[model samples]
Target: MFKNRYLYIFLHIIMWLGYTALPVLNAIQRDTSKPQTNPYTNPYYWAYVSFSSILLFYLHSEYLFPKVYKQKPIRYFILLILVIAILLVGRYSARINFVGNDINQTLFYINSFIQYLYIFGISASYSFFTDYQKQQSTKRDNEHERLKSELSFLRSQISPHFMFNLLNSLVALNRKKSNLVEPVLLKMSDLLRYMLYEKDDKQISLDNEVKYLQNYIDLQKLRFGDYVDIDFNVKVPTFSKNIEPMLLIPFVENAFKHGVGMIEKPIIRVELQTIENQLLFIVTNKFSNDVQEIKDGASGIGLTNVKRRLELLYPEQHSLKVQQKDNFYTTELKLNLRQVA
Candidate 1:
């Protein structure tokens, strides 16, 4: 609310104007007056009360509230008593000029004290509420920036692993002087271009992501040839949905990395489809019990990295499960396709 300067000021003016005009409204509404007329009806008394209320409100809000309420509670109580005494005495003095000596001073002073306290309390509460709101907004902004930085770092980790795998494929082709080298290098160029550009976006069309994956698979096929059997199937909506970039490739990469080496008749299968505005993807690879996971500093950002990205980007909108059973390693993911704010 405080973010808009003009609106906040206008609201403040409207509220105080209504409060200041209340006595005049009451005076106009009265059909008759008592034989001993009340001081509240007098324009002078009304003007004096309005000034006092406004003064008390601003004084506490601008000056005393921060120091007293935030820093020293005991001092606030003591200073509050002084404030009440001073304002009460001033109000009583102003009343005498209009009301004369006939009124009870003690009762008037007590009532004046209560009214001044009411204004002070309102001012303090308003200030505190605004400050609290600003603090919470700051915390949320900080958290958002923190998450953004972490996500960028995770994406960076993916780049080297991807480049390393593609480079290895190119190396194998170049060493053998294969005719497919040029085409594979061209495919790698497309993949590299997409990684260099599209990976930075918060969201990209699912079609683009699918194309990227196809390019990666083509490179892998060009490298492995008849030695490995790989199948990739995709069914998606005609109207493309949005998805986080670099989200689906790591699992398929893992399949290609481990499923082919020294294993008999190696096979890797990957399938993706959208049903009822939800994405379902599964990657399965046949693995020999003897084939072990290779660990290195330049290795692919594995399941843990992808899992964390899923938690951050999709939260409750996604589910992931990984299993090794009956000599097959399987990773399945279900993700909501709805847009998020």
Candidate 2:
């Protein structure tokens, strides 16, 4: 899982503050020595130790680990040892200058070596953890981009195929010299404009998407006229929400493609309802059992593409159910719009 960077920073700040203040708090509680004799009482010694620890931690985390450790592990270990030795020498010199010659030199050196090891270990662990997190984040971003590009290609395929079908409908109308042809052409123009311009957006207003769907239904109404029974109802209280562009059209297109021709009393039903952040969509169409079995690569490509898109884009945020009972094919989709993005 991903962690909030601000929260990580806040917790690290609290830890560092505690680490810096604990020694001073202990010295104050004991109150056993004059400022001139006690090393803990000397502000300069505290400043040097605190600043040196912080500087070494960042140096390893930001520079040494990234630039050296991954490429040259043995060299990095040698450099680490050198850094610890130098820090120990500086610490011993500070102790001699500030704490006087009465202190046990051997015991001080041992304690300082242990302290340096502790500091180095903490810095190394933290650096490795942060680098691992960065690598994971980069991998996720690259995968998202790949899925997005694939979805765009799938949508492009749908547009040309849909346009070909629409043009066929227009040709049929031209032969009959129907009065509805002009209106159908007008609606088709609007639909094409939306597909060309708005479809490229990552998302568009739900209201606009509904409008495009209505235009598509209207165009089909002109094509079939009174021969087919179609019911399209939309009950949306708000228009502020957004959805993936061209996401819903394929289902509706699939319904009209296979549901109407060579069937008695052809029927297609579509309903859309939105309550707060949840959206429910249903589409049901009648199909003739006598018709040839629809191949996956034939009229079912749109449905296949849509299923993959939903898995890539929404994942756990949406549910889709497709069922076939009797001579009717039904699809129901429930989407949690609030989970988008």
The alpha-carbon RMSD values of the candidates against the true structure, listed in the order shown, are: 3.1, 3.3
Residue-by-residue lDDT tens digits, candidate 1, 168-195: 7688778875888988989988998999
Which candidate has the highest lDDT of all?
A: 2
- The C-alpha TM-scores of every prediction are 0.86, 0.87
Model 2 alpha-carbon drift over 4 Å, by segment? 1-17, 33-36, 176-179, 293-298, 338-341
Candidate 1 residue runs with Cα over 4 Å from true position = 1-31, 34-36, 67-82, 175-177, 339-341
User: What is the C-alpha lDDT profile of model 2 across 1-341, one tens digit per residue?
Assistant: 14677887889789888987787778876775543455766777777777777777888888789889999989988988887778878877877776667778789889878877788799889998989999999999998789878987887787877787789789987776588889999999999999888987478889988999999999888888889999999999887788888788889988988898789999999999998888899999999989875454456777788888888778898999999999999999998774334
lDDT of 2 at 314: 82
Residue pairs clashing, model 2: none
How many steric clashes does model 1 contain?
0
